[model samples]
Target: MGLRLACRPLKPIDARRAREYAKHAMPSVHLTRHLYTFFPHLEGQHLIVEASTAGEVVAALEKLAPGIGFYICDERGRLRTHVNIFVGKQMIRDRKGLTDAVAADDEVHILQALSGG
Candidate 1:
């Protein structure tokens, strides 16, 4: 499913508000890698996408590799425990909701978190 934003004529005040909103919105984000085990076809390639949120970025990735999202996340749309997603230097706070904010220059890294006994 996709979301379509309806275009409408804006009044002077609304237009100003829209401009302000656009200023805060990031234009794009970079995906460093798509973990080989999960996305073999896109393993080494770095993908640049236009998305404001982490979820949107994953959705864009799904377009490139079908069922990719399922591998990274569960049926409830939560990030798997073994999967680690970082937007820039900090790890995302809401793993389950994926409501983390992402910027245009931010590097989004998705990789498997390894552990040993």
Candidate 2:
């Protein structure tokens, strides 16, 4: 099941209600434990997101947790070098634009790669 919010024009959303609505309706995002340390509020959240594309999923998550999108994606909105997002068991193909398709029931996993000696 999917519901599309009526998108407004290019106007910035300064309205609090609109933001709250998005938050209330947002699907819980499941990330790696490493990420949970950064956003403790997201710990143990479900792994579902409602969106057609991987990009939209990221956008929805950005609405829920501020700065999360940037942590997963670069300023240009491309997947970061150390971040990995999978639509399911398969990794996304379009890392640059995150245009990979995602169904409503699909589980999106976002993980940050750990590097150490």
Candidate 3:
């Protein structure tokens, strides 16, 4: 099965770019070999990656793309401060953490980290 990822309602960048990076985003196997075992199977857009259960997500992200910030949606469906992510059916509380377990056929939502008043 393939995972459908999606990252929308963003702030600065467009959805295409978001999907592009996510689609090809791969962590450095040198640092975390375990990630290569699972990430290689992940491809395409429409998949959402929320930091709710899997710690590997964060680790992989840091390795794939650094100096860039991801988003984490809050309970109210609104982007929170310093947080923007979601798992299968849960919102990520850890702004800098990924504890959600992502299945091979699950959708990974990478919400745009919203800011401003």
Q: Report backbone clashes per prediction.
A: 0, 0, 27
Q: Per-residue alpha-carbon lDDT of model 1 for 1-117, expressed as tens digits?
A: 999999999656688887787666553433334355556877556577777678877878889889978877899999889887788878888898888988866778777766788
Q: Using TM-score as the measure, what is the rank order of every candidate, best first? A: 2, 1, 3
Whose lDDT is greatest here? 2
For candidate 2, give the lDDT: 0.80
**TM-score to true structure, per model:** 0.66, 0.72, 0.36
TM-score pick, better of 1 and 2:
2
Which prediction has the highest TM-score against the true structure?
2
Q: TM-score of predicted model 1?
A: 0.66
Candidate 3: Cα lDDT at 67: 22
Q: Please report the TM-score between candidate 2 and the true structure.
A: 0.72
| lDDT of residue 109 for candidate 2 | 82
CA lDDT scores, all candidates in order: 0.75, 0.80, 0.45
RMSD of 2: 12.9
Task: Return whichever of 1 and 3 wins on lDDT.
Answer: 1
lDDT rank, highest first?
2, 1, 3
